[model samples]
Target: MKKSLLMLNAILLLTAVSCKKSTEGGNTGIIKTDSSTTIVTDKNGKVDSLSESSTIVDVNGKKYEKTDFVYKATDGTLVKVIFKNDPKESTVAITSNKKTFTLPKVESKGGETVYKKDDMTARVKGDSLHLEQGNNIIELKRTKI
Candidate 1:
């Protein structure tokens, strides 16, 4: 009887710990994944857990995520960025020039999202998305609706 009680207590304790809220960086609904692990952020932008995902895609022996982000520009330009969430290789594709550009996560600074491939780079700053190549920087802002 004592052993059963101890086992029940342990299970309840584990459940309490796992259900705690996650607050990663004030950005929520972000899912990051790799081959063996997936990290999810809650709506308040907190880290939930390091686990695996049900929506996974195998690419180059790594797991890609189906969760993506889309932002529309005022000029009727639509930009889409696909995420895989790997620590080293996060981005799968970025939309530019009426074409889809495949890229990866480069240098991330100040908790902002940045993707790059060769000389092209795309960065997100709040509601503004910036794409840079050579000396030209194109800025796209989201229209408030």
Candidate 2:
């Protein structure tokens, strides 16, 4: 009887050892059960610790959600802007009903010589002016008004 019991114990131990498996893939904590289903686990084998989802990325931040108006910088009746691309550091953006020009490195950050009415719907910068339209027509002038 003792010999039989010892042999049974040895067999059980071997079976358990053979059934155990070592996980690979550098501990991503994600296990694919099937083509349509997946299981995510944590360091301690707990599930649902962290979740991930798709998100929209905006490089210009929330400027599009503010308003639909053009920006320009001018002094009195004199326009400073003359052409686009002069201020290589400035970016021009537009929307359906408006446009926006962001100059992170302009004479004044928020200062713009705005125009919307008449045949002169234009933005005047220091020594340059940009025309606005449905597409991006923002330009940077190198001169000062």
Candidate 3:
């Protein structure tokens, strides 16, 4: 379980970096995720985090029930991810720079629903999500509305 979390955290970093590049011309990097809130860059290139009262995620075995993040991608596509608590699941459908990504029909890890591609793989567990693209991996938790 520790190893899995570590991988998830790594993927989170990758997602942060990818978002940064998509908007900032590939020169900035900011990574933040912990037991409470998840801070990520929005479509307008501003750092934002959801309210603690509205967003929740499990950390240290505690469940955090949160809402979805509704925002425009860098390419102007509407995107959002709904985070869950019990049973660990998430609903994510996003399109960036004319690229559409959605949930896959198969689950690659046990009962975990997988959304993947040739070089990218995302594993959703409740409110947490781990995405890997090539050597880049990112963990996304919490939701910002």
Q: Which candidate is the best by TM-score?
A: 1
lDDT of 1 by residue, 53-134 (tens): 2246555565555544555555665455555665355764665444778767776777577878889888965556788889
Each model's total of backbone clashes: 7, 14, 10
Ranking by lDDT: 1, 3, 2
Taking every candidate in turn, the Cα RMSD to the unseen true structure, in Å, is 17.5, 28.5, 16.7
Off by over 4 Å in 2: 1-110, 118-120, 136-145
Candidate 3: misplaced stretches above 4 Å? Answer: 1-79, 82-92, 96-99, 108-111
Candidate 1's displacement at residue 46, Å, is 8.7
**Please, what is the whole-model Cα lDDT of each candidate in the order they appear?**
0.59, 0.36, 0.50
Comparing 1 and 2 by TM-score, which wins? 1
Which candidate number would show the highest lDDT if scored against the true structure?
1
At residue 39, give the lDDT of candidate 3. 52
**lDDT tens per residue, model 3, 22-121:** 4446432332223365454444667645422334544555564554444433333333454344345544454333355654434546547776656778
What's the residue-level lDDT of 20 in candidate 2? 46
What TM-score number comes out for model 1? Answer: 0.49
For residue 70, give model 3's deviation from the true position in Å. 5.2
